[model samples]
Target: MNNVINWFEIYTSDFDRAKKFYTDVFKLELTDLPVSSDRHSQMKYATFPVGVNGIAGALVKMDEVKPGAGGTLVYFDSAEINDELSRVEAAGGRILRPKLNIGDFGFIALVEDSEGNLIGLHSMA
Candidate 1:
């Protein structure tokens, strides 16, 4: 197997809101697909194009799912975190923590999207 992460997903309760939030903040177009009969009695799921490549992940809703306090970390190819933070808020996301440094790795901040899913953004300046 190649040492690469092909895709990742964040289950959300509100598909439309999640799609809008990520699209606005990340500026990536999301394609939504109808769930199969085997999944949640036919709920909708969202697929997001990760970065510039063709890789993607499904954002689906599960009845047993709960809001994650902290888990997913997405790194944007940015030199500064403030700009992304601004975008996050403008895109209907709430900032959980301001930008902070983590040794020499870079800066990271936690935010909650419109669907109430918590995600982290990192920039290795």
Candidate 2:
């Protein structure tokens, strides 16, 4: 009822590659998140840095979770959509859509990350 979404997980087949892509684009290092139980040894993940009150999220890799386009699209907040879009390709991501004005809402751009996930970048400019 509050924020509606509390946490999110971006599934990936390659942990290191995905980590690099995210870190490069966002310019933030992701901390390792351990899978304590043996039952989940096949599963691996790392968490993105978040403020105390900010939403929690992680990059997860597991056999059951297939990373690809479609399904739920996660939008990342950006101060400059065009600047971020410029970094997408060099970071191992392909731009699906160039930065476009959204009128009152500002701007947005879509891209596919290294692991084939369609992620959106939103900005006020």
Tens-digit lDDT track of model 1 for 28-74: 88776544333323445576764566344656564534436543334
**Model 1, poorest ten-residue lDDT window?**
34-43
C-alpha lDDT of residue 2 in model 2: 36
lDDT for residue 23 in candidate 1, whole number 0-100: 88
TM-score of each: 0.45, 0.51
26-103 per-residue lDDT for model 2 (tens digits): 999898866533342376768787758666667867554468855344678777888878888999999976775544
Clashes of 1: 0
Best of the candidates, lDDT:
2
How close to the true structure is residue 72 of candidate 2, measured as C-alpha lDDT? 41
